[model samples]
Target: MNSLSRQLKQQFSILGAFVVSFWTIEILDIAIFSSYLDRFGIIPHNLIGLRGILFAPFLHGGIGHLIANTIPFLVLGWFVMLQETSDFFLVTLITMIVGGLGVWVFGAPGSVHIGASILIFGYLGFLLFRGFFQKNLPSIMLSVIVFFLYGGLIWGILPGLGPFISWQGHLFGFIGGILAARWLSSK
Candidate 1:
């Protein structure tokens, strides 16, 4: 296989592992833990709730929630990786940290937030802003493509979308993505 094909295969493998792990966790949470693992999600303002930053993205409310996030996660994530595989990792880490901390600091009191929306929004943010930061033809084109496909999702960041919707996570995740794009493109 050509180098490009080989790279795509590797990227798919890694992304597939991510999906598998998410499914496995969900299955275990339902079969054995009975969703008890959800408590590990962001609890906002509490000390122990801090762990949710790392765990929230992997925990979903139900099969529907996981299914909702799965396609966007894979597609946007693949777009980020198209430029450089390592970028996928960097963007994810930044999004998790920024988005998680934002939720911890500003999320509703006594609320437990759990979902992959944060990462999904993060990927969106990175892709949307990456071209602006990079100022290259390829980056610009990728940004346009991402915008056309997912631009409607921008509304998700606003408050009052729904009682269960973690708009803060989406907003913060997007911010984190912009930061990642800026940070990575600078180097």
Candidate 2:
């Protein structure tokens, strides 16, 4: 394959791996582990819960949660990779670390936060603001498009919006995405 073909392949592979992992883990969490995998999620202020930073995005509370996260994950993730396929991987890692740590530090002390919404929100924020940080025309246009498509999701970051939603994770994930845009642009 040519260079462009190889890049597309890589991008698809990365996106596929993440989405498939989400499904696989959820299947195991439900059918095999009997939802016990949920315990692996982020538990605020708990020392042992720190491990959730690495695992939480992969373990969803239910199939519905994973399904809700998958489209945005693929769509926004694909956009992030538009600049460089490998950038998706870096962005995801940074988002997870920053968002996960925020949940650990500031999330409710007794609650466990699970699911890929953190990454979803992180991706949304990154797409919306990356243009400003990078200061380019195409990126800015892309940012506008993202906002038009997903602006309503911004409300999800607010507290007390609904039951079982981790707005803290959404807020921190957004913060992390902004940081990632700045950090990546500086590179």
Among the numbered candidates, top lDDT falls to 1
Candidate 1 residue spans exceeding 4 A from truth: none
Pairs that collide, model 1? none
Report the poorest 10 consecutive residues by lDDT, candidate 1: 14-23
**Count of backbone collisions within predicted model 1:** 0
| Candidate 2 per-residue lDDT over residues 1-187, each given as its tens digit | 6998988888889899989989998998799889998998999999999999989989898888888999988899999999977677778888899999999999988899998889988988888989999999998999999999888999999999877899989999888888888888899
| Sliding window of 10 residues with minimal summed lDDT for model 2 | 84-93
Residue 175 lDDT in model 2?
Answer: 85
Please give, for residues 16-73, the per-residue lDDT of candidate 1 as tens digits: 9988988899999999999999999998999999999999999999899999999999
Model 1, position 5, has a per-residue lDDT of 93
TM-score, model 2 to reference:
0.97
All candidates' lDDT scores?
A: 0.95, 0.90
Root-mean-square deviation of candidate 2 = 1.1
